[model samples]
Target: MKNFLNKVLQQHSLIYKLILYVLTVVLIVFLFPKGGKFKYDYFKGKPWLYENYYAPFNFAIQKSQETIDAEILEIEKNSTLYFKFDEALVQDVRSNFDERIRQENYTSEIVEEILPIGQKIISSIYDFGFIDSQSESKLTSETLEITLRKGNLAFNIPPDKFITSTELLQFISSSLANSAPVELRSSMLNILSEVIRANIHFDEEFTEKAKEERIKNLSYTTGFVAESELVILKGDIVEGKKLEALNSIRRELESQVWSESNYNWVVFGYSVLVALALLMLLLFLRKYRNDIYENSTKTTLIFLNIALMVFLVTVVVKIDVKYVYAVPLCILPIILKAFFDARLGLFAHVLTVLLLGFIVPNSFEFIFLQIIAGIVTILTVSELYRRVNLFISIGQITMIYMIAYIAFTIIQEGNIEELNWFYFRLFAFNGVLAFLVPFLIFLYEKVFGLVSDVSLLELSNTNSTLLRMLAEKAPGTFQHSMQVANLAEAAANEIGANAMLVRTGALYHDIGKMNNPMYFTENQSTNVNPHSDLSNVDSAGIIINHVIEGIELAKKNRLPDRIIDFIRTHHGTSLVYYFYMQEKNENPEQVAIEKFRYPGPNPFSKETAILMMCDAAEAASKSLKEPTAQAIDNLIEKIISKQMEDGQFMNADITFKDIVVVKKVLKKKVKNIYHVRIDYPE
Candidate 1:
């Protein structure tokens, strides 16, 4: 057994790697426990499929947060101010009045006249008591009262209601006659004002604690039912208190302690379902889009994005199930489409939405809307980096979501008025978030080294530093590259290949000619033939060196491998024919065909093969004497046929029909280039 285990461990084959990856992903999926699934997800006023439910336990009815908050607010409105009355305040005021009279040296007769007014003011206020100005609640104030708590005893007194602070002062002054002595008036007002102190204050801390207890004590469960009873018949619209009661029981059942047998079986079943979904994704990629599957970075990015979408749904659902629509799920397709092809984008989106259905409420509706939105995104989005395409595609996606959601709503509830307007806002917000695709594409390019259409578009510009330098140093080669780019792009567009990629590749294909510009005939403006002084072998050697030099130049300049591939495979294994034949005539027996060949990994993709055809056809076309449409057509046929004989396009995954289209397109384009122009009369 030990030896067998060692043997198995030592053999780390592709199958073993695949199993390891699947297991790792499954383990991650297992990490997020799928909570108990209730049969129906009910919002208020929605029809339910399940029969009437009954409470399984004697549980308190829980109140909704909105309901409890409203009641708590009302309790606060009705609450009266609390205070601690000072029994000694009255006695203290009397003593101060008597002492002031003695200190001022007032006559007994003057004191008798003023003392009544001062005492009357103090007595009237003291009888009423100084209450807190919770004076804003006038309607309640009329009937309002405060409790002056002294230990265990409480006294209820009418609240002091004053519209303004001046109300108290006005009452004091109005009690005196208008003709009264000024000294007596001033002395009486001053003396009375000093004795009045506010004995009542709002006890905020105590009131808050009381309100909280009352809110907490509110019933969470409104009603009860017995088990094995029909809570509602099938097809009943579960709403209002009925909906609330059913949800409470559902929560109870979800939270109920799982038995050893039940827990194991449910977990196992859930794991299998998750694993099956993952397996289907893998199999689809491996079968149809093997390029994505073979590249671990692409596969990892796909899985990670799906996992991220699922994780977002899980977290949002956990916080509040209603807000699940706001999680920006549209970002999944845009990001995937940016990095990969549209088919792969739609595939991953559908799979992710399906996986999240287990957790999301209304699984069928959620799946339908998302899948439709994803389809719209894939169909409408042509170039993700194009600002207009991204905006229009996102708009279409949002519209699809809105239309589909409304349709689903009408089908479910049979009313347009039942549609939730907030969901429309959420879908709109989701569409706006689709702008993240370009930024995410940038990050994916940086992290995974994946190229996107946006970067390809930027790279296609001829005014870029390297392309500009190539034009200046080797104008002939730059013009040739431009011709080849036009031909390749046309052919690519005709054959449903990536036209932008091939065009960008063609623009930089011959940059190595810049290193020794004068040696090539096109760049040599003088009649001097530099190759005439060298042996044919040496000349062929120089020509062959351009491929290696171009590769080095591309790498130094940090071009993508896709572009470098055109530089590498444009000549493929084709020879520098003129020099090779000249050398072979001198030493026919000793000449090796390999010596004249460009160091090549022949074209391995449709784009590279198209560039190869375009590059060779354009360069060879320059040699035609008496250029005509028929001559150009014959030349194109001869050159491309020769390349085919040499097995140049064996690995490019292009069909014979596609090659026919490319040949037709290239011939038409080349013919137009050399078409005769009649001279005009002077």
Candidate 2:
């Protein structure tokens, strides 16, 4: 498992490393508990019940039971029947009926009355429910009488006034004494007994009605677990405590797991990935190493730049800072100038600015500002002739930054009043940071061995290290390269190509000419021509060996691949026509022109094609005498047209139109090089 993990880490890219860091942070924040407790309190008051049941009865005496019944019937004729009786008794048969009445009222008022009483009962039960188990009398009881009475007034008074204890008992006894039905008498007695035990009182009719209503609503107030029951006094405080304890335990468990988890592994993994990416970048740089240029310093600069990017990105996530996407943009140019050439820096800057949109996520406005500002920064510093002026670059960056901000605001349809300060601050911050660019370069160079685009320009000068070596060791080849540099640079500028590439390519194009210097025409002072003594095949072989020798020399010197590619592909597969023709004349129909061809993969790019055309045109134009504009134009046109026919431009991206422009520009430049002055006749 460890080996697999290490292998994966070794293969991971910078983007993958960044993604891992972000995921780790998310896991830490969300999956881990914050180690805080949660508490909640609930207060539930008891529901109340109102109304009560009561019995009403009257005494009656008669001569006979039949007479008494007839009198009750006459009384009932005037009033509604409101009693129950049993008819089986045969003694005196004097019967009187007693009726129990139940009161009906709104449930809310009933609840109000019952709640306080319920609360009292609950409190008593809680206080006494758990008496000593060892005791014989573990339960307690109490008895009190309740009275029921009808008011003299038509309307019912409040319950406290309408009923009295003496009245209820007296009414029950009197109803029993009369010729009352046994069933009615029994029911009244039972009700009186319960009322007495409860120690409460109510009007007869109202109490009976309330008892009936309570029975109907029994489901609302009964059958709850005794412990879980809530009354106004007890509230829900006990339940809340249990819930809070459960929550605290859950939180504690989460905190314990999070604190004990191996978080450092995540950090170590990400650090290792970053280290590996830096190592790869270093290896890539080393392949292009040059002794004359401080390659060590250049590699250091690149490393520091990558470190700064990682730092900035990490800080953004850690602090949760918002809307500073342009920070990466401000750092990119410095990085590009350090590791690669300045022209390549410009390209990288453009790509980096475009990528800022994805990095910032939904920040299109900032992305636009970065792109415009970056392009301006690169273009302002593009001219190799100008010294790097931080103030001027800042000024250009500031202008572009402001323009981008304003344009973004306008495009978004934002209000100027609301957004003006934001735009100003953004632009100001970026401008100030832009000024710090030069300082950053210095820091990069000091710490990381950075080489600036300005330094590269100085290195491209004629008196530079490689050029000096060439001049001292191979003067004729040096002169030849200088002439080629002039022509190629002019053609590059005229055709809107990379003039630096042309100039740099030209400078090293004939470093191969240095090997067997006298074997080539440029190094021969006298026309003794060593090749004159050799056979045509042997001479061609020696000439072809120079290209191979040049490649070997370039590698030993550790020249960049871009320069070496130019050296290898400049002649392409074009025939060494001069030598081929010489061999053909001697051998008649037997000589193979293919044998005399320069070993090449052909000019596979526009830069190499430019070098090839310029080298051939410059060398050929030297043979002209009394050169005129027309003559130079015709000569350049014929040379490039011959190369095109030979398929030298086949693999290159250069177009027919580009070739036409190259021809016209090369003609003008060659005419200037070979132009004649007025003759003074003797």
Candidate 3:
């Protein structure tokens, strides 16, 4: 039991990776639509490449969405508008009219005559049913008729037959114009205005309900497809009815309800496919990118990016499948290439696209477009810290999407007239969103405690806080660092290593020397050696402690670990020979060698190794009595060789050939620095 617990503790990284993989798989599968996918790939107007197809079961041939939409539009335009006829409202208006007449205290003869006229007007208005002006305006100008329902009977009448408020007043005025004198007619108009009400109101509820009933009656499927019926022959063009039939089967298969056993099988299938795609990514990392694979953080970043891309695409597909291309899948490759490398980025992008193929519509086109865009991203998006480069790359990617889509449309339709302008808009939108990559990278750096070239460029500036302090406190060491930076950068470029990384690392590698700058020979202006007063052991300790102090200072300043690596490894574990030998000769019996050595895990990458080589070569070249080409060459060889003998570069991923090329670069750069000229012939 103790051994089991110890084993679990020891393999925690592996366990974490396993958990990440499983969760990624589960999340992606969960994001996928809970439906079976059609196995065969088909396109309208394209030849059916598979064997003669048949309906697996009876299913109705579903109508196209355009057809269904057209049908609905027709129904909306021609459907009957309903209005409720209120028989009781007419009585209420009459009663109010009588009350108004009584309140006005009209003469009996005038009232008797006006009352009949008012009743006639009310009966006339209610005959066709008086409607509110608002409802009348809502009735389409082209609508010739409306259905007026009174009790259980519905009457189809011309919409103009119904009286609006304006018509009602006009009717009252015309009816009173002849029946009453001017004074009586004016008084009657005032009474009628208050009592008259719209007896027929638009029945929006009944209208909508009726429209819904009609729509429900509209056939979603035109005809039934019999089981085992030959749908389409192989090599037949998938057009018209054949296309419709094929699509109908696909729809039926996708939409059909699955039993518990079948549902579990489908879910399991999705899980397997998703797991396999991620597993391939893991295997590729393990085989070719073991450096990234071994570092759990880096591995997590890669998986997280993949999962993020998948999530974005899945969400978009869920909202609307046609807008699937609008997702900036290229951002994944752009970010990965910025932080890691192009190969890994492209590989991860391809895997992500392949996984998305299970969800997005037109899987072939989606996969092709995304993978192509990812490739373009990897190829074109260099130095992402530069805004213009990222913008230009995104433009190129957008153009590629537009061009590819146009080409596909031409192939599918045999013309450009049917090109979807909507997709082009989506692609443009996708490009706009890609501008977020830099901001996202900045966020990632903060979150993950990783550094990118952008941050490195910022640090490389001497004006930055920590670097400025280094320049102010230890000017000579700063100058030395600058020279080493140039040399290391040149060597890194020669060997195809991370030149910016090595250059930045070289700049801050010796920052610790600022603490006791004058103790070092370079910072002393006069013939004063601070080390002369101290015993050689203490002097060696001071010299060796710079690496340690540099690490502490870097941490205090919150320097990225990548830069701190140079400070930790510039001197490696080599002995401070001058002090060690001085102590050895004076007090040979008491000398302790370990006290003189720089604590180190050594340089573990090409960038760190380059810094180590350049730092040593630059500091040593200053000791040359007469700077000559041969003297410089011998100095470079001896120093590099001695360091090689001590196995300073064994752990670093630098080959002997890389070392030889780096040595050549260092020799040229050193000679240039010292102004070593060739001997003139007499």
For each candidate, what is the lDDT? 0.77, 0.55, 0.88
lDDT of 3 by residue, 585-676 (tens): 99989989899898897888999988888888999999999989999999999999999999999889899999999999999989988894
lDDT of 1 by residue, 1-682 (tens): 9998888876644455477457645654664544566676664556766655555556544555657667778777776555555557766877788677667778888877766666666676666455545532332535566665654777776654322344666766776545346757766766666666655455666656766777677665566666555566667777666666676666665556557768778777767777787788889888978877877778878877887788888788778877777777778877877766788888888878888887776677888888887788778887765799788877888888889988877875667987879888988777777777788789989988878889999998989989999999999999999999999999999998988889999999888888888888779888999998998888888888888999999999899877888999988888899988888899999898888887888998899999999988999999999778888889999998999999999988898999999999989998899888899999
Q: What is candidate 2's lDDT per residue for 310-398, written digit by digit as tens?
A: 34643563354343643546557644744455554554454433433323423356556666666666666554335456567766777
Which runs in model 1 stand beyond 4 Å of their true positions? 1-20, 40-106, 126-163, 177-200, 256-259, 319-323, 380-439, 461-469, 486-496, 514-519, 533-545, 572-604, 624-682
**lDDT ranking, best first:** 3, 1, 2
What TM-score does each of the candidates earn? 0.80, 0.51, 0.79
All candidates: CA RMSD in angstroms? 4.9, 30.5, 5.6
Kindly report which residue stretches of model 2 are placed more than 4 angstroms away from their true locations once superposed.
Answer: 1-311, 320-362, 375-381, 388-393, 403-456, 592-594
